[model samples]
Target: MTTIKLHNTRTRRKEVFEPIEADNVRMYVCGPTVYDRAHIGNARPVVVFDVLNRLLRHVYGEDHVTYVRNFTDVDDKINARAAESGRPISDITAETTQWFLDDMAALGARDPDQMPRATQYIPQMVTMIEKLIADGFAYARDGHVLFRVRAYKDYGKLSGRSVDDMIAGARVEVAPYKEDPMDFVLWKPSGEDQPGWESPWSWGRPGWHIECSAMAYELLGASFDIHGGGNDLMFPHHENEVAQSCCAHPEGDFARYWMHNEMLQVEGKKMSKSLGNFFTVRDLLDQGVPGEVVRFVFLSTHYGKPMDWTAKKASEAETTLRKWRTLSEGIEPAPSVPAQVVACLADDLNTAGAITELHRLASAGDGAGVLAGAQMMGLLTDALGEWARGVDLSVYEALLADTRDKAMETKDFSDVDRIKSALIEAGVEVRMSKAGVELLPAAGFDAGKLEGLL
Candidate 1:
């Protein structure tokens, strides 16, 4: 049995992972607010946790692990996007949610066991809020329900910030109706146009933080094995969830281990739309960058480190994947993944290390081993093999060979050079030797451009 170790953000240590029940390993990750397309930054956690989920299913029985990632369909951002687009909120959320699922599926991410939409869990949320108020951890005021942050002694334990420090450094919402400045909203009143539900306080919607807490509780229970998200959510979002959940249920430990992947960057700078570098997963996919290539570039860097998305990396990833695909063509995976690759994944998900091991396997010319290893890391699978399907170069090869023969006899290399240049421009890697001409597709290869180029 391989022992997995993960960096627990709550305790600030890398600890050995142990499920509350060996039969049922559970995890919850904060998912997207389905308002628009998912950016590259948003896709990081999906891939990172997908790998973790795969590893868990591999270790525990496939049916033993329960992974839950929520869809926050009832957010203010969704409301805003609906207002801007003049579309109904339900229509916008449904379209964007399917788009998200399609984009992630293209990236080789397996859907979680349970994807609970916030709207589906609203009754459960209302029930939890009622319990919090009864337990004196929350109160209703001015048609709004706010959590009493001070009620939980260890309010800032997860983030390691005192309430006073948070109030000083953070933007504490200064509402005249609130009792304490640091008090956060559990539920807020919604207008007629906005999405809302009937509650004891008012017709309103759940807050951003409470959505996760409530969904996690209903699906995963009061305590689960792991909770994960981007480090950006560490401060107020996760901190407030801890306060509300702990105060609501004191007996159960909320999440045994916490994991947070670092933020992503583009070419060493922050990715922003105004900077002309921000793009979604669908944008890259539509531009002919294979989804496997995107996944490779993402796994090259450790999840805990800041992953930089660069064109050079993408090109290199495409080339390497093409080579591996050719070598492992028609080869089936081994009975089990290699021990070295499994160990690398177990050691805090050292994916970069696992990739290094894969390079060694490729160098050793062990095609089956390499195929199995890559599949274990969710790469080079048959599902993502469409990008590697070779374009027919036989006709072009014969034409180039025939042209070279004529050039040798007539000393007229003009035609040969013209064809060679055209192939290069079309992203075909041309290899001309005494034997014949061999053409391979390189990165940025556009087979459509070779329509008229005999």
Candidate 2:
């Protein structure tokens, strides 16, 4: 068995992973709000955690690991989108939830063992909030419940910030009902027009942070093996979850190991709608970029670094996949993954390093080795292979070969030039040798563009 080391954000060091129980390795990841389509940036954490999930399952028995990711169906963003579109909040969340599922499936991400919705776990949230209040970590006033931040001595340990420094640096909301400015809301009043559940305090909804804590505790118990999300959630969201969970269940240590992936960029700039660089995963798929290409580009960069998505990288990845697919065609993968590739992944999920080993295997013409190594990293799977198949180049090869033969005899290559140019324009790589012509689809290949070429 290979030893796995992960960078623990809480300890700020790479530590060897040891589950509480060898038979039941558990993990929880903060999921999306489900108010809209998932952007490319949003897909980063999904792919990152999915890889970690795969590693854990591989190390432990397949049925030993339990992975849970939540859906925040109740949020201000969902309410706002519903209000603006004049649609029911339920309708929007349902549609966007399925959209997220479909888009992630395209990227070859397997669903977690458990996916809990915030709305479905409202009773659990209410129960936990009551425990916090009874234990004097929270206070309810004006029909609102807020957690006392300073009450917990280790409040800033995870983020490594003092209370005064956080107040100065963060955008703290000053409300009349709070005992402290840094105190966060566990539950707040919901208006008549908004969605709400009946609670002891009032008809209201749970705050953004409380949902994860409650859902995680109910589904994964008070303590779990791992908790993960993007670094963007480390400050307020994850910090608040730690405070509430620890206060509610002092017997458990919450999540033992914490992991966070870095953010993503687009073409050397932060992805923003104002810069015209913001696009969803579906956007890339609709633009004819295969999901495998997107996943490959992402894996090319280490998750700890800021990944930059570029058209050139996508083009190169597509070309690389095309070559590997041809070489590994009709080949059965090895029973287990390559040791070199697993070593790279076990060392903090060094996907870039694993990909380098894959290149070496492909260069050595080891087709079975390439297939096994690629599958371990969630690449080159059958689900994502449809894009590479169904395009037989026999007809094009025959036509190009016939055209070149006629041109060689007639000493006029006008017809050959026309045929070659047409194939090139259709994004087909035309390889001509003494033996014959071989036409392969490259990046941006459009079968529709070849309609008139034949």
For lDDT, the strongest prediction is 2
Give one digit per residue, the lDDT tens place, for model 1 in 1-454: 7899999898898999999998999999999999999999999999999999988888887999999999999988999999899999999999999999999999999999999999998988899899999999999999899999998899888889999998889878899779999998999999999999999999999988888988888889899999999999998889988888888778788888999999999999999988999999999999989999999999999999999999999998887787788778887887899999999998888999999998999999988888988998889998998988866778999999999999999999999999999899888889988777888777887888888987
TM-score of 2: 0.96
TM-score of each predicted structure versus truth? 0.94, 0.96
Task: Kindly list the per-residue Cα lDDT of model 2 for residues 269-288, writing each as its tens digit.
Answer: 99999999999999999998
Question: Which residue pairs does candidate 2 place in steric collision?
Answer: none
Top model by TM-score, which number? Answer: 2
Q: Model-by-model lDDT, in order? A: 0.91, 0.93
Whole-model alpha-carbon lDDT for candidate 1: 0.91
